[model samples]
Target: MAFEELGRFGVWRPFGGFGSEDARELEALGYGTLWLGSSPPGDLVAAEELLAATETITVASSIVNIWSEPAAKVAESFHRIEARFPGRFLLGIGAGHPEIAAAYKKPYDALVEYLDALDEAGVPAEARALAALGPRVLKLAERRSAGALPYLVPAAHTASAREILGDKALLATEHKVVLDADPARARATARPRVDFYLGLQNYTANLRKFGFTDEDLTKPGSDHFYDELVAHGDATAVVDHLAGHLRAGADHVALQVLDDDGQATLRALAPLLREVA
Candidate 1:
């Protein structure tokens, strides 16, 4: 199935912590998809377990790093998952940050080569999506693959991406949501998480394009930057903030709830799920 058909919202979780029971619960809660983050090489085994435990819901890797995992291995895993789950698996691939890679080469070139390898290995383009943030990578995703799955982006970026991708390509944007209503504490809790990505050039560049100044992109993002990027406050407020993405041309939104515990995060988000759906 095409990425656009995956519906309005999905759950984004780190692959390590969630078990089959958690997967089943999310499926029962009416999430159309489950996106696993920072998965290891050949880690689709865990994805298979989640897929096996749930029915109807689609499973995707928020990213399977291009550096560590070979295209052939990924292709094999894709085939295996597709054989069993069929239309329920969506492959989200990316050239992870240069700092993390052993070789530390040009990411765009590496991503193109990786996609070429996947193509040569007989992995159909429609079965995959890209984790792209910049204009060049977003265009590449439209041309070489199914669509783009951009993380931690605002609605303006989604609107810009839609213009670049035109009408047909899928545009799924990931948003981080915090359930806290207290402004100061919410921003405090979100600061560390936001700080990590603030130094990344892609994220910084995207923020610039979205009208944020260099000062706004500093160590801890400015209040203006944090509020735009991270959706915080009550369930209703969170839903209203997310709706901006849909209004801005996002085909789907993957939500990552920020909380000390994953179970508590899901529980807090339970009420907002139906609004997103």
Candidate 2:
């Protein structure tokens, strides 16, 4: 239940954003983990590269979509990574969206089956986590895996999830950050990202549970909705917003900086990482 390995602050980026140099840089900057987003392949070559590039930072899949990646294959990838990198790898699995996956159906049940396969394949429960959102899946994550990696949520949801996960389970929340002082400019960069997810039912349903109105979820999203999901402002303010998740009972916060190449933001936040850590 203790995910002390991942530490407090982690970086979340797509495959293109994270490379050998980037991994080394983030590691040097004191980031405890690097999450490979966008449903990384079952083979996990990208994870291996990052693991080999850095000496200590944990590398995790934001999620290997259960609908796309066979549980057995992912379990195999887990073993391969663990064998080479040891405790530096964490497998993050999820059902993804119904619209995107042709095989998506009874997602909760599919997740249960996938976990069973992983268990059969000898992947330790502590070695993986789930991209959980709802109460049911959150409970599943607590019972079956290391913890929950809920995405695009506010600190309030972290508090709610911690109540469900209790004191033992690892609760890592993924929060977007825009390191821009201008509110308009920040929201301009964040709106498209929010809009894309608004088209996905799972994300919208989760947002609604936290009191987001139908109006708030409409295309382009409301200003309040964007502000709640994405922390914007200077480095100090962004770090403070991310810390809300930790204060809300989250053990870790994976920050996804919105902009071209998150290097500048990461560099700017290097000194401030300890505040959130």
Candidate 3:
């Protein structure tokens, strides 16, 4: 139940985005974990490569879409990585969007079944996390897995999620960052990614729960919405905003730099965040 390995903040990147050098640099910068986003394959080779590259710092999947991956196979990968790297990797799984997934149905039930499979395969709950957004799945994460790792969420959602998961479960929320000082430029940078998530029902539903209306979730999204979800501005401002999640009750915040390759943003924020961490 101890998530000290995850530390105070982690880097969130797309699959195949980081090389061995990037992994080492992030470890050197004092980031506690590196999370691979965009539903990596069940083999988890990317995770293995990163873990192999770095001496410490946990590497995790932001999520592996359960709709596209078989639970048993993913569990096998978990055991493999755990055997080699031990506590250095965490498995994060989700049901994904129904619009894109043809087989998506009864997601909550499917997740229950999937966890059952992992359990049968001997993958311990504490070693895995769920890509949970709403009350139901968040509760399930609290009961069945290590905790919830919700993406594209604001600190308000983190606070609510903390209420649901209580104090013990790992609450690692992924918030995007655009390190531009100009509000206009920052919002522009965040729009495409925010718009992409808006098209998905799950994200919209979760946003609505946090008081984002149709206008706020509309194309281009509102400035307030952008500010809430994507931390922008100078490194100090960005670090302060990310710290909001910790204050709101998250154990860790996963930083997904929107425009940069993640290196510059991480390097810039590392010093300021070290004290916070």
Candidate 4:
């Protein structure tokens, strides 16, 4: 089955953290999708409520940890949400970081098993997506699911992923945007939030493949690293940065704003919503 066509750029934030009223407002603002970040087990049902409250906007789990939720449970949730919301729900599942899943042995293998179980439970391929960074996992996503949903990556990776998945599968990427124009402050605001991921081998290796040097991958991210990973400055500047992902072959881009205040961040991004739609 074909999922709803998401716009080039959508808003990325935590679902439970945002009020239903705020979600309605975002839907009314012409945003094509809402991507929820790192949710706990059984949160997909709550995600469905957010989608049900809005009209025409797709709501996706930026990633639901495969180790945290069993495929059977995920399938049940998917069925319920799909029956209720239909094409508006996209299951974005991933093998979470090794550190977090240290107790769960063989994560990659476990992810394969999870996907198998999801299939056994009758979740359709087009209704699901994988949070893949490497070529191996990207190929797996292509064969087994809808496509790859890569996070904290550059446009070059999107181009490569498109090649790996071919033209039919989705190539949705997550991008961080800072409304601040000041380079230092913007990087500072984005650093700690993304620092942990930079330390992860999956993210670092992806950055390295995209031509970021070992020096560029250092802690808090080098200037070059920050510049490429986090888009900063005015609304137009942020829009320009996101456009590169489309140019590089991404099917969809989810924009996560890093700002001091949530309300202000939404307000600052209002003008750019027109460009996104």
Candidate 5:
């Protein structure tokens, strides 16, 4: 249940052939956790595989959707993983977006109800986190789970989230990174990955709160927006940018690289990550 168990830095990637394999390597590089993002299995199948891969690093789901995954089933899956891995699994759950929700009513109410179900199903509050962005949800995260996992947000949002969460709960933010020397190509790599997110109200509204203009949020996202959110350039520059999130408020920054070969990308940054550690 302790946040430190999750580590100070981690890698957040979609399920891939090298997921567990790369997880072992990241562990050696001094990373504390490996997060499987972009909605994972309702059974938490990946969590078991991840924990089995490394001896110490915590394995977390960036989110399991509340609208789709039943709390009882999810809790059961958590127990299954924890039984084998013990304290190495973190269950991050979210209400998801309106577009994906079958019946998106009061999302806050749904999230609360979901948490209540987890509480009844024997899921410990310290083992889970809410993918919250707004104030209401941030407050809910403070009370219900370990802390908040805000994705596609700037350092300002992390500062605000930390203020709302206070000092006790964990504040793990996802920082998208592109380690490329070429500005055009680096931004090109990041834009496509986040374009769909801009369409999602939760992400866009959060961006607006940080003072992003309407123009900055358009189709491909403006240069200013890219520079504001993504950590690009060489390995040192990217590491420095990621450090800014920690300086702002993040307890941990889950690095999400915008590259086809995630394993290779991380390999290149091993030295930089070591310096951070």
Candidate 6:
């Protein structure tokens, strides 16, 4: 009924750039987990460093790309991290975008093979989650991994993913928060990122199902769409956005504070985010 390991909320930050000290600060701030969303090297060596730095905060990959990092190698890394950190490490994997991978096949099938390899290589199912955005993959996540980790989605999508994942699997949603109250400035900061995502078919397809129109899905995205997706404002506004996920049946919400990142921002926002608990 709960992802006690991941806790109720966590911070989603770049895995490679920040170090153990940054992780320690987030732990001190009361964030339950440190989700590594930015792509790190295939070895997951950075994750181990973060684990060594903190006693209680969990460290998870919002995703490690299955395309770039082979399952066998990732599986080996998984085993090593698990051996050192045990339950504190969670391996998150994704099929990635066709534009990103030259050999992007039927992603669902590719993901199936990846999971199979992980199974054979001693990567436990409970220690992993899939960055799934659709029904087919969401079902696979429920059956094979811990659960679904949907990104760049709204509370509506979280509700849908929960239905697809049912009660057993964890529904950990990745939500972005910009620490600015100005609507125009916030959307401006978020638009370029949204434009890049618009090029990805997987993200666009999922957002469409969530009721975003073609015009809304256009480059830079409509202001309404951007505003709905990014929780742009002060810490209080961001907490309200994170709560929407919990209310929509999300077991955990990965707090991805956009643009203004690093240890200082986490420290500044910690008190505000912890109040939500």
* RMSD, one per candidate, in order: 1.6, 1.1, 1.0, 1.7, 1.3, 1.7
* Preferred candidate (lDDT higher): 4 or 6: 6
**Clash totals, every prediction:** 0, 0, 0, 0, 0, 0
> In model 6, which range of ten residues has the least summed lDDT?
257-266
- Encode model 1's per-residue lDDT on 177-217: one tens digit a residue: 88789978889988987688887877787778889898888
Cα deviation at 224, candidate 4, in Å, is 1.1
Error of 4 at 166 (Å): 0.8
Summarize candidate 4's per-residue lDDT along 132-174 as a digit string, tens digits.
Answer: 9998899999999998899999888988999998988899999
lDDT of 3 by residue, 1-277 (tens): 3699899999998888888998899999999999999889999999999898889889999899999889989999999999999889989999999989999899999999999999999999999999999999999999999999999898889999999999899999998999889989999988877678878899998899889999998877888889898999998899999999999999999999988456987888899999999
TM-score of 1: 0.94
lDDT of 2 by residue, 92-182 (tens): 9999998899988899999999999999999999999999999999999999999999998988899999999989999998999889999
**How many clashes in candidate 2?**
0
Mark the regions of model 3 whose C-alpha exceeds 4 Å error after superposition.
none
Cα shift from native, residue 236, model 6 (Å): 1.7
Each candidate's lDDT (Cα)? Answer: 0.83, 0.90, 0.91, 0.82, 0.87, 0.83
Worst 10-residue lDDT window for candidate 4 reads 1-10
For model 4, the local distance difference test gives 0.82
What is candidate 2's CA lDDT for residue 87?
Answer: 89
lDDT for model 6, on a 0 to 1 scale? 0.83
lDDT of 1: 0.83
Candidate 2: C-alpha RMSD to true structure equals 1.1
Candidate number with greatest lDDT: 3
**TM-score of structure candidate 5:** 0.96
Q: Candidate 6 — which pairs collide?
A: none
Candidate closer to the true structure by lDDT (higher is better), 4 or 5: 5
Off by over 4 Å in 5: 16-18
